[model samples]
Target: MNKATLASALGSPSAFGQSQFAFMRGNAFEARVKADGGAELLRLVHERLDPEAPPPKGGAVPDLGASGPEGRTARTALALREATGTGGWTLLDHPLLALDVAGSPAFLEPDAVVVHPDGSWTVVEIKSFPMLDGSADAAKVGAAARQSAVYVLALEQVAAHVDPAPRVRHTVLLVCPKDFSNLPTASAVDVRKQRSVTRRQLERLTRIEEIADSLPEGTCFAPDLPPDRLTAAVESVPATYAPECLSACELAFHCRDRARAQDAVTSLGRSLRAELGGLTTVGSVLAAARGESGDPDDPAVAALRRAAALRSEALGGVAAPRAAAEAVPCP
Candidate 1:
């Protein structure tokens, strides 16, 4: 895998991993995908493969770095231009396949890898942080480390085929901005903590790999749609979860519309919980209100019993005058 391509692959996976299942609804996502391009006769096949969505790309992205993202590439290119003078970093972009924690594919693509004359490789994950602080954002640093770990995994599988049997070590170079709000920094990156953070990620991901290998197919924690299905929907696309929704899910709008028609008491467990207090679905709430008790200590049962007592006092054949003390609002 080349640098740019590796970036695309590793880039989106981190954010998209949790949403895999939601994205599996083929028809909707497919429509969303193909809506980008034209000639959509059967194109919107974002989820599963049914001749609706197009095939997935061989890999993710590869050109983002070259475009001077955050000035990382420009700086790296300049450094290479100076270091090699006539030549650039041997591997400007490349992908490595290290097993993910689940033994599924965890990949890495570096902006550049400094291949030494001695055949040792120093991996660089360029950053855009400014040089002034000599510090890195803890969250951003963690993400880079995790991303780099995937590359470390990928290279283990595919590096030997290259010309040099480069001694691969987990090295990351973070390129940052000279100033926070200023032009992007393509050049300077802090590497002091790269190895420490990266080591932890490797350990974590490998555990994931072990667990994945242990499970059978069709198990939880596996991709909602198989890799093949993902590939199928590359160009065709599908209906998105939903644009105006909270999670950006394709069905979010639909669910919201459905929710508006019913009160929480008549809806799901959570809704009842919200409306009637904890564990207060319609059945349980009604049961309590009727004084048909379950466990006396149960809050639901108690609340219902209390309401029943109040109603009986007020609605008995001869109603007593209102309790001059206070008023009870109608539920």
Candidate 2:
């Protein structure tokens, strides 16, 4: 089994060293939601997704069956930490955290952890990309920050159980080399904003818990459900909605096929933007489809309309049928 795929499927950790894909499939099906294009697409994606149905010939060379320089970067980070003999912090690579919320649960895990002698703790997330140049993009950094916040929230639980020293608050991402031969760079991060966002996410998480609690008895999660199903549910997002999820999303072949059938959105999380139906998209929809009338006299809505219009006009028609109306012109 592809460990990265399974970790993604089961909402488990993304450890290169770990080789487990047990609950991935069942978890994937169970994670289907109407908002995310439903389970049918997920099933279709999974069914058609495998590039390598046959087992790979290589022995232990491919850790977790992950690919690209990013995969090696993750594995090598583990090796380098041990090689450096750095013991100040807890090294949690692709770790999973199960956070308790009044009986229901939420999970958060970051790639690495470092406990300073001064008692403060930092969460280390490893990504394979250059931190320099335009390599460190906003959306990617947001993803890293969002993922790291889970660790800090989970660490809060540890704080309650063990003797309190310093809270795990900061996040540090270790970016992979743009050039393979070069050393990986460490990018320190403050995910306090992520923490704030997490607070809101937990509110939504709590809602999901309520939904699950009301479900029928025999209709529990699938066979491949991870230890904490809720977190697993959150993480088991399929490639269709989350094609940019990770370096080794097992269902890529399927997702690419699906995306190719549709029009491409190359700037940032274009596909994901289509999926979420949030501010950016809603704004776009209003501008293009609705045209000038999409904006209410409300100042905020009008500004958004103007911006969407400007974007459409600037793109010179390459954007899309509806994407043209994304950010409308301001009044």
Candidate 3:
């Protein structure tokens, strides 16, 4: 079964996007770079990664292609081992690396990996985002960094299995379009910070086995089940919902609706929840703001009351009176 279904079962399904133009463009650019025995890519690696060292006259583009993912991954590992032993410049195009994430193996396919003459491997990340005038969007670059960090982590795991473990460089090559042209511009992005963050986050994740063990007996998440049964099965597992989940999760809408119906304060945003202190519900906050019931000594309640008074004063004869009249009385 696909890991996506497993993720959905764990209450973290991803949303699908309609347009794949950007992905296509990225693939096209990557193909362009790898064309002609990856001559252009070799040039970029020489210029950006190792300007002082001698450039690769002509490198081996070993085809590690196989039938299935596991077969291909095995082929990649063998190719990596061979490349490291030879101590030559080798490009493993679309090499797969498997990392143990939260007691599960997550296979990562990097754009490319360059094995230096010194047996050190560098992760290459190709992005469609243009680097205009030697600069790209900071946020886009950061996202790319995080992604490369994951690749680096996976590479390290593979390196561990090999004899005389190869060094995985912390600085990854980031290739992007130069200005508006199809030409590729390369930069070495240091992903040490991102690597640490990703490693820590992955380490902190709860194991899928542990989550599965916590589920109620006979609970099922089969898609063909009745609507009510499916909903009940899903609801049997707890989900921590927030606005940021909307971008990453397919079940965000369902979680959002449930949260709003229950008046969960976290649905607003994490920052708001932090600011509101003990006032966890919207109704409770509003009641405190209206001076109905709440500890006056609480800083959040006092601030709410102050803000409410200021708003009432500013709109004294206008929207405030009408809104107050129409509003439901505090229970």
The number of the candidate with the highest lDDT is: 3
What lDDT score belongs to each candidate, Candidate 1 first?
0.41, 0.46, 0.83
* lDDT for predicted candidate 2 compared with the true structure: 0.46
Q: Each model's TM-score? A: 0.33, 0.42, 0.88
Tens digit per residue, CA lDDT, model 1, 194-259? 545655665665354454455555443223445444333321222222223433333343333334
On the 0 to 100 scale, the lDDT of residue 32 in model 3 is 94
Off by over 4 Å in 2: 1-96, 101-103, 106-109, 133-135, 171-173, 178-180, 207-209, 212-331
- In lDDT terms, how accurate is model 3? 0.83
User: How well does candidate 3 match the true structure in TM-score terms?
Assistant: 0.88
Instruction: Name the candidate, 1 or 2, with the larger lDDT value.
Output: 2
Residue 78, candidate 1: Cα error in Å is 25
User: lDDT per residue, candidate 2, 1-331, as tens digits?
Assistant: 3445544554444533332452453233233211132222222222322212222121111122235544543443343233222322222334445566545554444544443323444555555544565257777787777777767776665555444334555544434333442334345567888887876767565454565566655443453665467334433443343445445454344345444445433223555454323334443445434454444654555565566556766887466646645443343
lDDT score of residue 165 within candidate 1:
45
Candidate 3, position 318, lDDT:
57
Error of 3 at 328 (Å): 21
Q: lDDT by residue for model 3 over 1-331, one digit each (tens)?
A: 3535644654546676645887788789999988888888988998998887678878888998898878888899899889985756899899988888899887889999998888889999988889999999999899899999999999988899987898999999999999999899999999999999999999999998898899998988786566677778778878878998886677787788778988888898888778788988877877777778789998887777776666666677355633432232221
Q: C-alpha displacement of 175 in model 3, angstroms?
A: 0.7
lDDT of 2 at 270: 53
TM-score of model 1 (CA atoms):
0.33
